[model samples]
Target chain A: MDLVNQILNSFILFKAAFLILNLILIVFLLVVLQQVFAMSSVITDAFDSGIIRTVAIALLVISVSLFLTALVIL
Target chain B: MPDLFIAPLNKQEEPKQSDDLLMSKSSLPLTELPSNLHLFSSFVANPRGIHFQNQDSDEKVLLFIKRDLITNIVWVGISILFIFIPIIIAVASPFMGNFLNFLPGRHIFFYLLLYYLFVGTYVFVNFFTWYFNIALVTNKRIIDVDFSSLVYKNVAATKLSLVQDVSYDQVGIVRSIFDYGDILVQTAGTLDNFHFEAAPSPENAVHIIQDLIGKEARNGLS
Candidate 1:
């Protein structure tokens, strides 16, 4: 019985580690996506006066918020 | 011949090569030609100018092929770093002993497998980025297409005629060593500057644009 419990616990720990790693990867991917979107907007607004930077910052903020929410859920 | 057929032939012949007939009628000296004639005469007299204009207009629009060397280097570095993770796992495998026995090869195979997977993904992403971000130039316009990430792309272009000035700045020692820097193109009608960062041989690019502009100006004047 003790050996069974130990094996189950190890499995749980392994599952948790994988979950956490997946969460990290998701966050990294989201951050990268946010930057990419920002860069796209910047390129689109290459001729705009000052809206490009503002839009990029707003996107970054939104991505961070989304990442935090995902982290919390995870 | 029938009157209708004869009349049609006379009408066709009336306008045939009238310029020659007009020149024969005009007894004015060749030196006192009209302004339009003077322009044609100047063009004819300077075949070099015409050739230059032709070559200028034929100037090839060049687009910078995205090498993505920086991205590639970063990916390689990340892959190398990830290799260390497996090393750590291997080193700890002995300490962990039977606890990690279920990991198959005590994490050696797992680490190696994960490392390869990560490296493969990184290389794929880098290659895709390189394959997409391209610059396009034509006689009339210059375009910059930036594929910064997998899901996003940025494309911008400016008319060749609207480009007022082009400047290249390679400030840092690293940039100079790497032969890459920013190219700023100033447009006549736009307040914003089009900046191409990390472009190779930025000075040469600027010179190419300047030469094109110069040729266009000459053509316009002519």
Candidate 2:
């Protein structure tokens, strides 16, 4: 029974690590998105600004989705 | 108007500046440029797609440059290595046996997915840094835009009239082979000088800037 409890505790740690990593990534990506928006506003490249912003937004969305999935399914 | 004032014969005549375009500006366009120029090129002339903050309506961007693409090879290579790590681990998993025994086997796939997503973020951030860190030579001013990271974004500018001298140097075998170097502009007064680092074709950049400063000085705009 003690061995089983130890194994279960390790599994909890593994899951917790994934959740914490994903949460940190989500925050970092939010900052990135904001930076993209602010920088694009400062120097607008008619051809590439929109595309860069879209890419940033896409990354943020993917990150949030992954975080939610990890919370529910990890 | 010719100077009516006579110079003393005892005093030596001051030598005038020899106007020379050290590097040929023949290829640089003052007006229209080829429409096919790629947006990602490290050097671009007459960039129609570029517009910056506080730019005058009449201002025309004469030149645009960024650090050479070769400079990004390190990050590109690392990102590629990161992309393949999950595959390598999955293939080696059987040999390691019980390495991930604490966690359910199927859940490992989700973790791998999360890892790749984080790697994607790394790539995105690096790309953004490269894309935005650039310098521009407009008809009226010089702008150096430096976007290093989320916490640091620097945009430095000085009027063409304030530019006193322009020079570029290509050192090191790599810089020579890649044909990109630093272009330094000395400005007068209290304004800070501009340094365009890893600017592609620094020679031509210097020539273009010299021409602008010369024109501005001739018109007594400074």
Provide per-model DockQ scores. 0.04, 0.68
Choose the strongest candidate by TM-score.
2
lDDT of 1 by residue, B48-93 (tens): 2111111245543333323325535677787678667767776887
Where is the poorest 10-residue window by lDDT in model 2 chain B?
B16-25
Model 1, docking class:
incorrect
Rounded to one decimal, what is candidate 1's iRMSD?
A: 15.8
Error of 2 at B215 (Å): 1.1
TM-score of 2: 0.86
Name the top DockQ candidate. Answer: 2
Per-residue CA lDDT of model 2 for B21-41, tens digit only, reads 212446454333332335467
Among the numbered candidates, top lDDT falls to 2
Instruction: List residue ranges in candidate 1 displaced over 4 A.
Output: A12-74, B1-61, B65-72, B91-99, B106-112
TM-score of A-chain in each prediction? 0.57, 0.89
